[model samples]
Target: MATSEQMEAYSQFWSLTLGFAAPFALKAAVKLDIFNIVSKFSSEQGATLDEIIQELRIKHDADSIQAERLFRLLRFLVFKKVLALNGARYGLTPMSRLLVSHGSSSDVFVGGILSFCTSEVTQRSWQHVDAAIKRPGDSNAFVEAHGMEPQDYVAAHPEFWKVIEDFRLSISTATSATITRVYDGFKSVKRLVDVGGDTGSFLAQIVRLYPHIQAVNFDLPRVIANAPAYPGVENVPGDAMDFVPPGDGIFLKSFLHMFADADAAKIVKNCHSALESDGKIIICDMVMDEGKELHLQLDMMFLSGSQRYQRTKAGWKNLLESCGFGSVRFFEADPFSITEAIKN
Candidate 1:
């Protein structure tokens, strides 16, 4: 017979397993624009369930059953603490307020991230995790489930890819802000080269913050073509693997995690070669550390030969030092780390 304590622990495991339900519910709420609808109709007393349903136009002639089901969903959200219910009305809580989409430029697309994370294409990858473990190497969950890489899959589905792209852009904006605020080494650099800089957003933020710094956003030719112009920032067309534009400072913001260690080392060597004698190399990325098990799980979800995975602090230090850089230092930021390495 199972002991009471052991059974209790098993029950807790089941509860943790059921955590998927919350994200699924949140995904539906995002699709229905529940938060936006509630925000639009909210008053001092908050909005009634009927008002929300009416605003969303989800009612039909057979109303009771559907209304009850919608009520159940709303009540789930209430139970999850994303919303609140008093009397017959529901109101947005701080958590729910994040779903409201409002911003003209450089807005963080929290809703887009929510949707993309729970989207069919992304969730499909999780379904094959078991298979990936059973059969390792070049056959990740994503590859097994989709029969193609993520970028190729996105190219085939333009509309869906746009949402993912929006999420990427939002992440880029947030990352740029963090790098700009915490890292001050940019002051010494006259020329900054952003290797694999996508859309020039990072360089744009950097040059605007430090007017004295001139930056080159270097990526593939097609990537450079689509980059937005920023004052004192030039978009250069070339592969970083082949050659990085010679500069006093080399910035690799979220660039290296996508490649395997060997390839990343090659890119780091390229940075070393391109950097001036006294110049510094800055890398903005997730650094695996203590109490980051959840981050490790998310890292594993990328899966495969040269997928986006984090490096440990020591791993980063060793990698930089191996690339002929000395005096490496790490600056911790929100869910990411900035590593600075000076040429030997």
Candidate 2:
């Protein structure tokens, strides 16, 4: 007979296998708009199973099988802490509210993120990861599965880009508070440009914080054309590769790490040209350390061979210096590092 310790270890291994289904369930909950329903209808005691089923358009059957399935999903979600259970009722938890369209996290669109991640195209690419690794050179799993490069694939599918942009917006929202609190360089700059800034959220935050600074939200033509009007920020439509708007301070947040060295170099050089001799370039992105597992994992998830693409502290200094910046400095920022370089 197996020892209790051995049996427990085996049970944990099997439990992890069930983790794969969690995403799908979460996606279903989002699709059903369960969070909104609960938030809208539930009293302080919470929404009962019957109330939830009625809101869901699910009929309460005599046998209660379908109702039980829905109840099981809710029960599992409550176990996952996405919902709080009070007797037979369910209520929204903080994590679940992020999926709501009008909650505090409304801007992040976590439901959209879940929908995109669970979509067939994205999930299919994940299945080919092994094949991508086995290929000889620079093979992306997405390309292997979809027959086009990741950028090309995203371009062909507008929905994918929407998801990508939403993901970027979410990250920006999460990091913006810390950045505004810690970074003091924004005060002196006369004009600041946010390259590849989507929807002008970051730029909006900056202008709101420092009204003296004239902020420009610069991005692809399509992106800027659709950008919502932000007070005190000008929306400029252009390509970061071709040209960046001239400004005293250029800010790139979570932008450069997606590319390999060559493409990143091109963008860096463009920023160099767009800035005056006294201008400063501030890069808020991952500076990967060899020993940091979480950072390394994030790097891989964003780009293959992230070990080569994600810069170390020294790597960042060298890249900026080569691009004509006189000096470079790095500061620790959670989930990212702030790299500042100034021209001579």
Candidate 3:
């Protein structure tokens, strides 16, 4: 006979092993369009299993067994707190709402990110994690699995790029909301330049908040070609590595983290050269916190997929200070952190 503590420890180990089931279940829910259907009904009233099945367009004859399976899925989601149980019906929880497409209360939707993570290409890369670790700096799991770097892979597969672009936009949308709320340093900025501003989504939000500022949405030529025109914003196609357009305020969101220290420092130096005297460079990227499981997980993903890795607070400070920046300040935010550094 085993002690209760021993049994409990064994149970926890098994639970950890089967943790992949939750995300796969959520992916299935997204594929089946379950959350969107549940959103049609009020959370108080919720949606019955029968109603969900009907919305899903399942044949009536298969309902006996299929409905039971569907119920189990919803029940598991509720257990995970991705959904709420209202009497016998199911309702969307805050997490589930982020999976929904159009009817979500918040502007940010994470369904694309979820889809990209669970996609075949990404899943295959995860399978080679052990090999990636063994090889360390020499091999990337994504390249080992896909035969190319992520950018090259995305370039070859337009569909994957679309999913990636959507994921990028979702992140920008979420980060922009937090930035506009917490930081008011943009008030003094007369000219704003957004480096790697994909589709002008991030710059558009900033322009909306501070209409007085002249904004330049700077990105690659291919990226600029796809960007829609925004009022009081210019979409400039160029390479930031070579040169960045001059601006009093330069914004680099989710950009620097994609490079190693040498390349990142070069980019920072380029921004420094482009800035007017006493100008600022604002960076929104992950600052690794050892205590946060999410940060650790993301750092691992970065390590496995590319040459990039998340920086610690000290890493960010050193990079900025070495690149001719003064008065570096950090702001806390979910998913990503903000760092404001004024050019010396």
Q: Cα lDDT of model 1 overall? A: 0.80
Worst 10 residues of 1 by lDDT: 101-110
The positional error of residue 3 in candidate 1, measured at the CA in angstroms, is 2.5
lDDT string for model 1 (1-344, tens) is 99999999999999979978988898878777777778765445778887877866752333443678778899899999988888888987777776766533224346666776777888888888778778857667887788887767767877876776676676776677676678788888999999988888778877877899989999999778878888888989998778889999999877798787888899999999998897899998888875777666557556532246578989899889999999999888867779999999
Task: For candidate 2, write residues 24-125 as lDDT tens digits.
Answer: 889877767778778775446779888877777752233333687888889889989999998877887778877777645344445655665677877787
Q: Clashing pairs in model 3?
A: none
Please give the distance, in angstroms, between residue 118's alpha carbon in candidate 3 and its true position after superposition. 0.7
Write the candidate numbers in order of decreasing TM-score: 3, 1, 2
Between candidates 2 and 3, the one scoring higher on TM-score is 3
Predictions ranked by lDDT, top down? Answer: 3, 1, 2
The C-alpha RMSD in Å for every predicted model, in order, reads 3.4, 4.0, 2.3
How well does candidate 1 match the true structure in TM-score terms?
0.84
Cα deviation of 100, candidate 1, in Å: 2.2
lDDT of each candidate versus the true structure: 0.80, 0.79, 0.87
- Per-residue lDDT over 156-225 for candidate 3, one digit per residue giving the tens place of the 0 to 100 score: 9988988888778778777888777778888899999999998888888888888899999999999899
TM-score of each: 0.84, 0.80, 0.93
